[model samples]
Target: MEFAERHDLLNKTFTPRSPVNQRQLFSGRIDQLAKVQRAVESPGTHAVLYGERGVGKTSLANVAEQIAPIWNSETIALKVTCNSNDTYSTIWRRAFSKITFSEKSQSVGFLSETSINTRSFAETLPQELTSDDVENALQRLKKHARLFIIFDEFDRVFQASSTLTLPFSDTIKSLSDNNYDITVLVVGVADFIGDLIAQHESIERAIVQIPMPRMSSVEIGQIIDTGAARLEMAIENPARQQIVKLSQGLPYITHLIALHSFQEAITNNDANVNKGHVSIGIQTALDEWQASIKTDYVKATTSVQKKNIFREVLLACALAEVDEIGYFAAADVRSPLREVTGQSYDIPNFARHLKEFSSENRGKIIERTGQAKRLRYRFNNPLMRTYVIIRGVAEGMIPLEKIR
Candidate 1:
């Protein structure tokens, strides 16, 4: 029975995790997947992945591990994230744990090389291991088998780069040049790693590199169908187009918006997802984007990015309503953004963001009709713009619509 018919059935929304249900919502990433598969199968395949945040970099890696078994090789994938506390010792210990985790290790033959003499490591481990201790343990572990250690978000260790407790570059190099049975994969997007590489060329050579690509509209539709399928909710045709356009063909955004829309509809006791719920979800997604910008975007901490992103998107969403406005361009609404932020950004930057969701990029502005190109720069997430407009009005940054 349809959700509308079964009033007794409970409603639930999906949650975001490391690897989103790609099979369900995973869209056009076959080429990307094949590239990653090749990396995992190759020995000592060290790679650096770069993409807009939420572009499924982590999911790709997770998927890489899942498909590793298909290839004829003993693949043990250990995924550990790097952060502020990732000292040399912290890295090795976490690397050790990830490497040893039964979920990954059991599939492949990963055993400590040295005598199971955990006496010292055990004695000192409960307390955080300093950089020195980890380096020592790593040297000891070197004797055993070839290990593939993946450090996700490796750029989070920006501050510690100058004072690295262990010679990270040298270690990876020694293992690689020596062709030790060890490999390293460092993944991040914070840009610090790329900058760090310029400063230290040798470390750059030790690792292989791979950058994840964005999703296309067809792929995004697949994600929407997958997400809706899970809820037993089939999206109306128009809603799918709105999602694809609003999400800018991003898998993560697709999943996020779809999940939020489903949640909104279920929460409000709606029978099926319609434009109303999608509107609400767009707002929620905007709020999340605001929170994300505020989290580490210290430069424009006062919701600077939020303000602009929201302003342009909000205007477009409002503009999208008029029937003649079948296709609205962002350039059609730049004035609103300037008014909202009280300052101008690089028009090129703003224009680029029309396609790229990141604060640094501009949203793609498209003309709905006519040979004359419609001009506009809207945000990738309509919700992001909505959140900004609401907050701006709340902060007295932008006046109410009636006043505007």
Candidate 2:
């Protein structure tokens, strides 16, 4: 590859954590993006986007903020990220301060000539406030421009103060019902809406809930192709398939794997990434992610027997049907366990391990649902699944052919 080509590709090809800005670079989220646009355009409609960590919830929020205005010319999107210490008053204070209002006119008795004074809602916004105060402030601001306020990491509000949930929920419902020109978009990491906010029946119809799921195989492929195209590089079918399969539906993993593969090929003075480059890329990603995965793995497996059992369980989960990447049933894991361990263990035996893995104070590696006969489970962290896949292959627990 030429120096200019390599430099441009390296600059444009990889972004593991930050949100993608260019529309063509963003991939596989057409539906969610459309929902956000619709909610922004329609009167009295707000949205809440919830999903697992690293599933691109924040990225979608960022992209929506940029494009929502395309559907409505008056829309103005503003976003604020919350921390564990954020409260309703503090968060709203920050939001109001960020709004850039046109300067208000002021006059002096002697010099009645045109004079201007800058002002913002936050200047007079009370420290001790209620939902009504926020609604009133938003109502006044909406006359100038339609608002799209995004509360990224919104779960922090409730985590900091559970009492704020009802107030926040009430404020959202009131703002929506009153037809204020402002639409609030809440983004968080959770399995369900109720987990993030208070379970209020009144909120059921007040907000448009968009649950962001893991990317599909086709979507992951788009990301690979889009990045490779930008870099003026090519990824062989085997290499592309390897990255997507091991990504486990998370876009971050895809970026990490692809970045490593790109760097590996560049080092070798090659433009095409083959399975060999992918294999090395996997090892590199595994090394970079080793510390965190080992910490979680050690926490998940305390006993020798549990450790042995978990190795088999993770390999089985990785080997599950492509459709069932993060989630798999115990029955799905049984066949692989028998293959790996050559020992027949009943569901009852695995049940204890699952319970421990799902416990809050313990492993917290997985979450399970359903009854005894139809139990299902999913990795709480997609990185854990990626770690499992890499470990399985490195340790010879999983065959290379299986992943390819």
Candidate 3:
């Protein structure tokens, strides 16, 4: 392929910094997509999609919105992202503004179909909004038309005001009770459903709780294979396995590493991407990571003494086994620590380091959960965990041969 053509193909195939907007570019998540489709198709049913960061929650929501029209010709899908400044009234107004309602004039003797009027749903809403007001306005819409409203980044609204979710709960309950043709999908970064929606008990029976875990190795490989097929590129088995294992089940890491590996092969005029290309790709990924992540790593590992174990402990924490929500206990770190240092270790040896990582003094890189007797830890940002592992492998603390 020509130089410019390969560059274009790379750009079209990989999206590390953006969510998957087109259905053709999306991969995996078949079961999650089915649940979302079912929610939209069933009257009086809604959905809440909650998961850890970088797990592709927004991408799923985007694809769900795009496919709604295919399921029903009269489906009107609308979406709005919530920010710290958004209120219940402002959010509804923003969503309603995207809806354009068309009205036809009555036909007369000589002026048949004189004109048509078009207006946004926002114009119909009163200045101050409430659950009853939203329900009444929605009820006025054509009975045959189905409405799908997706509120992305809903955690931002919850962070701004815990009470804000009550209005939404009430609105959903009202709509479900009346069997309206409206479906609401809430997408956010959260470990649990309650973290994103307060007063959810009232609407518990009305919505489906879809928790998006990290992608499986098979699913992550599908992303690489799909993109590589689009570019007519071949990836060696070792390189492919390295990317999948290092990705640690996060799609963002897969895209980042795969994009650079493909670029490395193209620059070398090679027909296939190999292990060497993956090495260069890993280095490039580390170099291009956000400054904030780098800073957080330094803060967590820096020490005044030359023999300090902060760096080793933090790396062990990265390699530690985590549960579905990403929480890992101190005991989980002991095994990885021993493997890295070839020395016997215990919780007491690194417990203080773990505490410091969770403190503001160490940039709070890891968050502590549970009581003192049964404390568990997880990285404050899921992406940070991936960064730690990659950095470890690059720096020789984690041997590449032992990654999997």
Give the range where candidate 2 is weakest over 10 consecutive residues by summed lDDT.
Answer: 317-326
Which tens-of-lDDT digit does each residue in 1-404 have in candidate 2? 58666866675667775666667788989999889888887778888898777778887887887886787888788889998888888888888888765675657788677756667668878887778889888878888899999999888776768777877888877876777767889998663368434556666676888888988999999999998887778999988988888886788888888888888888888889899998898888777874767888767765655345766765666565533235688777677667666788777777677777888655678878788777788877777877787778777776756663
**What ranges in model 2 sit over 4 Å off?**
1-12, 104-120, 195-199, 302-307, 317-329, 342-344, 358-362, 368-377, 400-404
Top-lDDT structure, candidate number: 3
How big is the RMSD of model 3? 2.7
- Backbone collisions counted per model: 26, 0, 0
Decreasing TM-score order of the candidates = 3, 2, 1
Model 2, C-alpha of 26: deviation from truth (Å): 0.5
Q: Let me know the TM-score candidate 3 reaches against the reference structure.
A: 0.94
lDDT (tens digit, per residue) of candidate 1 on 70-181: 5535555566878886776566676666544112123334663432322333344545665455546656665654455667777668665555523665565555555554
User: In angstroms, how far off is 1's CA in candidate 1?
Assistant: 7.1
lDDT agreement with native, every candidate: 0.55, 0.78, 0.87
Give the candidate order by descending lDDT: 3, 2, 1
The better candidate by TM-score, 2 or 3, is: 3
